[model samples]
Target: MWKILKYSFADLVRSRWSYVYLAFYLILGFSLLFLNNDLSKTVITLMNIVVVLTPMIGTIFGIMYFYSAREFTELLLAQPIKRRNIFLGQYLGIALSLSLSLVLGLGIPFLIYGIAQSSEIWDFGFLLLVGTFLTFIFTALSVNISLRNENKVKGFGYAILLWLVLAVIYDGIFLISLVLFDDYPLDRFTLAATMFNPIDLSRILVLLKLDISALLGYTGALFQNFFQGSGVFISLGMLVLWTVVPVKLLLRKAIRKDF
Candidate 1:
């Protein structure tokens, strides 16, 4: 597993896209910090982008890597190595590479700006943590999609569709549902629904941590009140489950897949 992981990680790290990914984050981080000059606000803005962008990147990269390495993967399958190790190593490699891009991209600017001296340190840390989780979760999902669909085009299509539903359409549907049923109490319903989507959970978690859930209006306040206590733990727990389940499914599929 480690060997496969090391190879995949090194392969991606040496790729031009990896440099571009890292540079983009670095540029964005510095730009945001330069323009905003406020750690809390910057962290909030970053939270919005990280939650959406990481998953998309993860999905695209995972599927792309899987398909691109198909020949190599088959060669490995012909060897005596465990299928679980091969797939998991590749998955982790893609996820970690992306996560590294995210961290270094954002971390450099923040650290330069002296986030260590700021009160938003934990908030910023949590934001990166959530981004990493999203990367891992989505990468695993995309790999699963690739494994299930032998056609590269179909795999890419399904991966993007999955991201769209979770990132954009899911929020749209959630809001529409809330409006349609506004006559009744929706606190618990809203909470339950948010838990269903990792994106929503991430947004809420960061907002709550940054002490700015008020911008979410009544809904935000409701989230603040409910999650203000032990609720953060519950949300984090859900994110953990989100990250773990997809990888489990990926491994299960990989082990049983016919090469």
Candidate 2:
């Protein structure tokens, strides 16, 4: 597993897209900070981007890597190796490489800007943490989608559709439901609904950590009171579950796949 992970990560790290991805963040980080001159607001901007972009990138990259590496995967399968390790290694490699791009891209600028001395350090850190979780969850999901569908077009279609539903459509429906049932209490409904989508879960996590009272509003206040201490753990646990469930399904599919 380690060997496969090492080589897979190396392969992806060497690709031009990796550097492009890294440079994009480097540029985004510096530009956002220089323009706003506020770490807290900059973090909010990043949160919005990370919540939507990471999963979409993860989904596209996961399926792309799977199909692109078909020949390589076949060669690995021919050797005496556990099927799970091969797929898992590849999945981790793509996820980690993308994650590195995100971290280094954003970190260099913030560190230079003196985030260490700033009080928003934890908030920024939590933002990055959520981004990493999102990378893992979506990559695993994309890989699972790829494994199930051998056709490239269909796989890509399904992956994008999955992202769209979670990122945009879900929020649309959630809002409509809130309006439709405006008279009834929706505190628990809203809370549970947010957890169901990783993107929403991440957004709420950052908002809660930042403690923007205005943004958190009434519902946010309710969550603040309910979660206080253990709520962080609960949210993180759900993100972990989001990543684990898909990867476990991927492993199961890999094991049974007639590679």
Candidate 3:
């Protein structure tokens, strides 16, 4: 598993698209920070970028990686290796490589600015966790989608659509719900909605750190208190679930796959 993961990581690093993507993220991160001189504004902009871009990049890269490696995957199947190991190795390799790039591309700038400005370390830490976990979640989902379809275009499209639904459409639905339920107590509903999408959870976590939970209304306050009371462990558990569930489903498919 370790060897396979290392090789997979190396392959990812050598890909031209990897460099392109890294440069794009780095430029965007620096640009956003430069445009917003205020720490709170900077954090909000960073969070928005993370919530929107990280998953899109993760999903597209993951689908492309697996589809491009179809031949390699087939060759590996011919060897005496467990399907679960191969799938997991590849998954971990992609997750780690992309997550590392994200940290270097976005995280370093955020840290430098945060430290120089004497900003809250907790917000920076939360951003790091959110970025990595968001990658893991999208990668896992993308791998599952890739394995389910033979056509690379179709698989990639499905992954992008899934991301759109979760990251963007879900928020729209929540907004509509809030408008419809203006007279009802919807804090619990909003909490449930946040749980359904990791992007929203990530936003809530960062907003809470800035002491702006009240702006989120009742549901935002609930999430703020939830994270504040539970801290890193809760977020870690959520992230672990995000990675584990989809990978587990994919592993079951891989083990039973005729190939």
TM-score for every candidate vs. truth?
A: 0.96, 0.96, 0.90
lDDT of 1 at 141: 91
Q: List the residue pairs that clash in candidate 2.
A: none
C-alpha-based local distance difference test score of model 2: 0.91
- Per-residue lDDT of model 3, residues 166-253, tens digit only: 9889899899989999999877777667777888777777777775667654555565576667744676677678778998998998
In model 1, what are the clashing residue pairs, if there are any?
A: none
Clashing residue pairs, backbone N/CA/C < 3 A, model 3:
none
Expressed as tens digits, the lDDT of each residue in 55-171 for candidate 2 is 998899888988999999999999998898898899999999999999899999999999999999998999999999999999999999999998999999999999999999999
Which candidate do you rate higher for TM-score, 1 or 2? 2
Best candidate per lDDT, number? 1
- How large is the C-alpha RMSD of every model relative to the true structure? 1.6, 1.3, 2.3
- Candidate 1 residue runs with Cα over 4 Å from true position: 214-222
- The whole-model lDDT of each prediction reads 0.92, 0.91, 0.82
- After superposition, candidate 2 runs with Cα above 4 Å error: 214-221
